[model samples]
Target: MSTERDRDPAGRARNARPRDALGRPLPYGAVGEERAPEGVVRPPDRALAEAQELLDAGRPFHAHEVLEDAWKSAPESERQLWRGLAQLAVGLTHAARGNSRGAATLLERGAGNIAPYAAEPPHGIGVAALRTWARGLASAAAAGRALDLRPPRLRA
Candidate 1:
């Protein structure tokens, strides 16, 4: 039997199922962390603060969702930055989930994506430091070493 997915008010397919702290979807009607509404156009400052708060709370997956929204709605010039941040969050999620391979790949990729901004980072983002942090974690994870997944400061 085919199961129908949840839909938003506009009929767009949305996952209304509750999610765990790591963003894993639980069964319908299961109590889970409250998810933020999607597709809203949050200003950069708001997005950053929200994402940072989530990250600090050990909810990297939730942070990724916020960053993904920013990336999708960002201007061309800033799109990659948001994308990188989202990737970093995903990397953290993988780390917490004990997927070292996934964590390594995403951490490296995300660091590379954000490295370009090192020369002249915008929004006061700590791109250089963040890239260094991710690279170090990625290297350790790749070497079969378990590393602590601490939340990096998003701003300089």
Candidate 2:
């Protein structure tokens, strides 16, 4: 039984292995493929608003998808900002999934990536505050405590 991963981009069978939700590879018969979500990148303002909405809805995975689209389509200079936001969303997703170690690592990495943009982040995202929040979350996760903190808003 050939799976999607076993097939190349053109759909030809290969040695590719399928993966599960947590990204662990599955047996040959198991089904799953890593595909980007649909939709073009919206303008920065609209994208931030939409991503924030998803995050607030406790759908950090979806938020990460949205932010990833923005990251892929952003100008070279702004890529880091979008990437950082996406990472943060993924951190939230990991936290929601009860993966404390993964959550803490992603949160800290996201915080570091976003720090340089703190003083003047696009869309007024309060990067500094968000970084502090991420740090707190990381610390809590490292201590084996899960926090249910409110999602940060993207201001302006």
Put down candidate 2 lDDT per residue, 56-122, tens digits, no spaces.
8767776787888998999998888888888988887788778899899999998898888987887
Q: Write the per-residue lDDT of candidate 1 for residues 1-156, one digit (tens) a residue.
A: 224887777898977778999999887778999776788789998999999999999999999999999999999998999999999999999989888999999999999889889999988899999999999989988998979888989998
How large an RMSD does model 1 have? 1.8
Report the Cα lDDT for residue 42, model 1.
Answer: 91
Q: Which candidate tops TM-score?
A: 1
* Stretches of model 1 off by over 4 angstroms after superposition: 1-3
Measured against the true structure, the TM-scores of the candidates, in listed sequence, are 0.94, 0.77
- The true-versus-predicted C-alpha distance at residue 28 of model 1, in Å, is 1.6
Question: Scored by CA lDDT, what does every candidate get?
Answer: 0.91, 0.78
- Clashes (N, CA, C under 3 Å) per candidate: 0, 0
With a 3 Å backbone cut-off (N, CA, C), the pairs that clash in candidate 2 are none
In angstroms, give how far residue 73 of model 1 lies from its true place.
Answer: 1.2
